[model samples]
Target chain A: MNTAILSGRELNYQYNRSQRQPEGGKAALANLSFDLFPGQFLALLGPNGAGKSTLFALLTQLLRLQQGDILVDGTSIRQARSAALKSMGVVFQQSTLDPDLTVIQNLNYYAALHGMSSREARARSLVELERLQLGDAAGKKIRHLNGGHQRRVEIARALLHRPRLLLLDEATAGLDLETRANINRHVRDLCQQQGIAVLWATHLIDEVEAADQVMILHRGNKLAQNRCEELLLEHHCDRLIDLFGRLTGTQTGELTT
Target chain B: MNLATASYCFLGIFKRELHRFLQQRARFASALVRPLLWLLVFAAGFRAALGIAIIPPYETYITYEVYITPGLVGIILLFNSMQSSLSMVYDREMGSMKVLLTSPMPRSYLLLCKILSTSLVSLLQVYTFLLIAALFDIVMPASGYFWLLPAVLLASLMLCSLGLLLSILIKQLENFAGVMNFVVFPMFFLSSALYPLWRMRESSEFIYLVCLYNPFTHAVELIRFALYASLNLPALGVTAAVTAVLLFAAISAYQPRNRPQRGKPPS
Candidate 1:
């Protein structure tokens, strides 16, 4: 029940901000480490500039792991890249779907990439689209859809392969409050119903629930990692947002330990 | 990925490229117009000015229109391949490339599929141009048209590989326009595309050497000879060798650094 589907160990990465500076001045992610258990939702709570997307990039193999290692479904990403990649799905921060193509076309293309037959691709895509309440818009171009709809299409596309691990990097950014909450809650339900591990990265404090596993990330540092309620209890805080506020803003939220 | 998966991946990429090419009506128009203008207007003007000696590809003195048709074919291919790759740069900027790179296949295999797909689309455009040229009475030998198919596909692959390499190396989409100018223009102008090397040699020995050494010259020679029901061994060797090198380099360089910067949440 506690088997980890995703494991990131001592991961470190630096952005080369300038040509003259050899190895870069500041590290984007410095010695970060965590594990995401199967059927569990890991909320990576971090503000802007908190190395959330960098970590996501590394996990998705969009960026090379500069230091340490990452494993997906017991396969090291650095070693067996294709096998590791086969085990996960990622919905990046930006809209990655081609605007000119219809939603179904995009989903079909993704299915083909994973070697699914056309019959199977259609079946799986229809199931995901219906679940996302996007069945009617399947034939419409991505550009014709609104932001919330487009995002929903992306989520459907991501899940068509039924990967064991799903990684979303600020997936609900810039949406309205209702849409944001809906997307957040929907993704949370996926972990429970589908038995898929999820690593959801976001800055919004309210996106996380009191029962979820939350990790506070700031300036490439993991400030705290525990259940939401336990973190509030341990930090002597009334709510999750206060702990988040204290840790992320100003002269740091000094941890009791 | 397994062989079956790789084949499916290739089919997906091929269909997507063909779909995109078909959707963009203006792209097809522009691709045809560029070559047609050179063939109809430019070649027509230069016919009397540029006399052709009996080139090897031509057993006798060929009309200037016939001589330049193969070069015009080269133009369509060079521009089409580069245009296909320019869309790659656009995909990078638009973040669709990240989606592609993250697919459950080897990066090298994915890139290879992309090259083949674009080459196939470019082939369609080339054949369309040939059909239009035939309508205008600029016809090659009957068998030459059939034989030119393989040569055209090979040339398109090499040119597409070069374009893909440029797309990877070109960091910004804005920088790609400048690169196309530097690469496409010099390749077309300095090659045996427009005029015979002997003609260039007569004008300037230095210019002749550049044309002789330019890989585009060999590409054109291959197409020209193939269109005349003949074969050029040297051109075939050069094109095949260069395709291997460029393809290897492009696939190898498509690592982390070559990928476009992801839209981070301001970190």
Candidate 2:
């Protein structure tokens, strides 16, 4: 398989704090670079306002690239955005589902947006729902589902396109610890089983496992990128919590797991 | 985008809009009720007071209800277009618009599909109003029913484009209600929808001139002429020109380079 499914070089973005002062803006993302090979689970660790979502926005072409470029399987996101986006799927931090729409309808609509035929979309939707143990809930409206279930349905919808690269932004936000851990496991297993590269962005440190590749983003800059275990050892910390606290300038008070 | 993909995207968006329209019973009710009230109650009250002379389409003086039926249809189209724009604003706030923008299709195609879908729904609302108008004994030539479809479609596109342009100008969903009132009410009253330009000229030449300049006047005239089984060349020409210009502007507003940043952090 082609190893590097996604890569970015010198990605940069800045937002004007005040419209009147054009020069008075802070860099949201600065000179960041990263790569993800096929079947790898890469964790993007950042606190709030650390520019994790900004990077996702750049990758998804929701925000125009101010500088540099991103490539999906060697296809340039800037030069050929459509072709680059065709192989990727995204789960935003906020709920994007139509609350009035049934789960099946939502999945089919997304599949159609990805250019899948109705029959193929239905089949893939069923398979994805089954994978998420949501087959029976397919007929239910999204408003009726719990927060965790809704997120699962969103994941199913995202995967219906069979994207090789999955970009998830705070996918487990607002869920209980057990539900969050279960979702983390499910996505991790999806990475290994489907051989799809996953970039999971979150502020939670416990979600990162020892084997996953970790990229610590702080204030629009990449502080470190390495295997989670090696990073912990290099930082001289027993737990990722302490390491993350040190990097983000916050002290860990309580550990969940 | 390829033909197959384009067709799929169009169908998907169109179906979603249709389903949403169907599910919102209150929207459907209000959309129909507003125009019907104008035809039945407002026209009834004004029938004795206003006098419409021998219009070109009519050899004899016509009832006031018949005179304003075409205008009410215009009202339906105008309100529906603005309502759909409100949906676009709501979609942006709810994060669904992001999902739509991320599609692999060209941005122009996606936005066009969105505008066209809303136009299609507005067309349905137009026809429903017309059907109710006919049931009230305010009938037109049978051929007008068929020809009015294309006229309504064109008018809907023009009005939908105008709504989209306003949506782009007005940033927030919360502000949409105020904008809708300012735009929809003025456009409807300033045009020939409620009163003829000639009648307005009798009262105030300036308002008559304003009505002449209003694009909604041409839209209503286009449907009026089509309903009479005749073509109004100037109305058709102006409506088509306005549609092209506004559609271009709307598309430009939605382009990624022109898309405005919502909050401090990107999502």
Candidate 3:
């Protein structure tokens, strides 16, 4: 396989608060590193406060790097943020779409942010919305659309720039099961067909298929990383749910009651 | 920063803000109403109570309404600045701010674009107010109307920069109200908005000098001079310098994509 499309080395980040005692600052991410291969779908599994969102923020350049470095297609994020961002698409955990704007307008505005002309943006937006099965809702305001449709619009907006890598931070959190499955299938197909790398952050282990790579993060540290099947077998757990419990040291049987 | 890219970023943000204004029609109406109420009701009530003094910009005794037009303009700019900052906080909470800040453009250029967009909206509101003022026979000289544009632009820059800085420093929307009560009121009141600096000088030279140093005072003075078809170099210089400083401070405080530190989480 070609070199990883995105990689981070010794990424360390600590929250600095002047009002806190000298030692009170929290280390959100500590000496963590990973590489995402081209065309591979990698799911990051972690519990709440496991630094999943923090890592996403750092990767997307929302937060400055306090230590270490990130590379996008071999260019350092610090040295070439614009070029790096150009190659990456991000769907944040929260909704970034304007509620007042129609689905098409939201996508067009995002395209403009990337410096694309209106004509080109409209053409691409139509194609992307069609591909996402949201063409019918193109003219509806985001506030009028259901959560699932709104999420699809966000996905369509992210792809308008045609980035080589896609970063999704809980992109399907509030969607219904059927809608979530459809989104996952579409994302999987996109990765396979376009040779795009994907890093999907989620707490649910079922979201990670047997064929895909899985990175287990616990308390800001990467505990294990491998194909889902290999990880399950190595832990002597036949099911992903059981394996997830073993890996994260959570009480597995308690939920059955 | 590349000037072309900066211009593009500026235009993009400007368009977004304009769209926001169109979407929030109620907000625009409310913004207009507050100033109109002051111009009509409050100015009418105070016109007889307040005595007038001949200032440099005014050759003859002017009505209280005419004297306070520049101050009311400053009020529009002030409120718009606070609204812009409030929206910035809302954007951050909603995550759209990340999309704008992460663009390849320099942080300062992005902020300047935000300021420009906000100021454009503020200027639109001010012109509308001026039109109404004209209907009421409070209009300045025709030449003064032309100078209003640049004066308004400078005042918008200064206030918007201050708002941008506040947005960066304030972690929560709740605290912004306190800032409004403390910062906005003092700046508006202590400045020569309601009275001339010379009037304040008779009471206390220190208050006069403080007013002289206030960027808002300079903003009002600049507009006052423009209202007479003249210029105020000191006011223009002070406003520009303060704008540059605040803009620089705001840009320097921006931290790419990194999440700002929220206060201590519950134990």
Candidate 4:
């Protein structure tokens, strides 16, 4: 098995809304490149329109690669789709779980999508639910759960396949501070214990801990990528918010704490 | 596409659709109710006003209830197609469609799976309608039941493909009602659903030709012929050709990696 779980080289994408564009030529992502190794927790930080979602779409094969290539576990996403998807799991910025389905049902359905048998799916679902502390909410409909619990269920569902690489796009957008911290700790623990390569994408600087690898994106370009401590040292800044504001050119508002 | 993978994908989507329908029992029942009202009450009143005509599939004179059974079947398939497409739009809005589209499977196969799943659900609803029709003594020839399966399946595929094609072209759910008004009623009324093509000819050969060309007409004719264990070669050919065209068009519109692009912020 390849140690490098996810790698993208010179990825480029453009959207041609013929009516809006000047002759319909607008680039969404340009020459973006990055690599994620096993057991590494990488945080992708960018402004709202900095192409982070576009990058996520490209990595997950949700958007076509107009230029460049991506390989998941040594298999090109375009050429070896089934094999690549089998080795990777993705959680989009928006919720994907069916509100009508129970927590257990949602996980089982996702397992079935990967061709698992009903019995195997149920067993895996139980294990994932237990891991996320959602075992008690297994029979409850997803609509009944609070936003934080729903987000946890989504994470647990993604882990059902035991994918070597887990991609989370804005996984904690609306969670309260305590809930976000709990989920973050759980995810970090999972990466350490299971050695799953994680690519966590978010715009919030607070989400990046003192120790994870950080990649800052601006205008579809990778401006900076290094250890959290190193980035702060390079920028002569102690707080992540200050560094982020400097990198992305955004004004900082009142601090949460 | 890989047939084995396609089969698995089809089964997975089909099962999910079935679960959804079962969970939303009111919607399923209401879907059946619309056609039932047309078959029992509407057909009952029209039976007296409408004159009898000698159709090939009918050995002798038949009531309007028996005559419109196939059309009622078409109605179920048509409504189900629109319903499935509506769900697709909803899925796109809710982000579940992204999950299915992002799967390693080919886009065409994924779409075919969606069509097949919706077709199966439509067929089930048709059977439920047929059972009720039987209770009301609006049954066809006893042997017609077996042949009805293939006819229903074909019609379901054709309608579902058309629905899939529509979903790809229409980007938003708001545009759906306009599609329903402009497409659904015209296809249903302009075809031989409520009246024979010959009857349409008496009204106007131009209208009759339009009916002959319409795929919905062939779908209805195919079911009508099968209701008597007879085959309509022309209807079969037309239905098959239309299905192929629509499926091709649908698959072309859906690219696995075609994500919504972000635009510049408003000035």
Compute DockQ for each candidate against the true complex: 0.51, 0.62, 0.45, 0.43
lDDT tens digits, residues A1-257, model 2? 55588998998887864457644678898899999999999999888888988998889888877788898888788788888788888999998999888998888788878888888989999999999899999999989999999999999988988998899999998899989988899998889998889999988888988988999888899989999999989999998888877876765542233
Best by DockQ: 2
Question: What fraction of the genuine interface contacts, i.e. the true contacts, does candidate 2 reproduce?
Answer: 0.58
Docking outcome class, model 1: medium
Those runs of model 2 whose alpha carbons end farther than 4 Å from true positions after fitting are A1-3, A17-23, A252-257
Better of 2 and 4 by DockQ: 2
- Runs in model 1 lying further than 4 Å from the true structure: A17-24, A248-257, B257-267
Q: Please give the CA lDDT of all the candidate structures.
A: 0.85, 0.87, 0.83, 0.82
Native-interface RMSD of candidate 2: 1.8
* lDDT of each residue in B1-267, candidate 2, tens digit only: 778878988998898999899999999999999988888999999999988998766668899998898898898889888888888888777888887888888888888888889889987888778887777888899999888988999999998898888877777877877875788888999998887789999999899998999999999999988998888889999999999999999988888677765457755
Supply the DockQ value of model 1.
Answer: 0.51
lDDT of 1 at A242: 76
Which predicted model would earn the best TM-score?
A: 2
What's each prediction's TM-score? 0.95, 0.96, 0.94, 0.94
- Write the number of the candidate with greater TM-score, choosing between 1 and 3: 1
Stretches of candidate 4 off by over 4 Å are A1-3, A17-24, A253-257, B1-9, B257-267
Question: TM-score of predicted model 1?
Answer: 0.95
> How much DockQ does model 2 earn?
0.62
Per-structure clash totals for the candidates: 0, 0, 7, 2
Q: How do the residues B192-267 of candidate 1 rate in per-residue lDDT, one tens digit apiece?
A: 9888998899999999999999999999999999998899999999999999999998887787755443334221
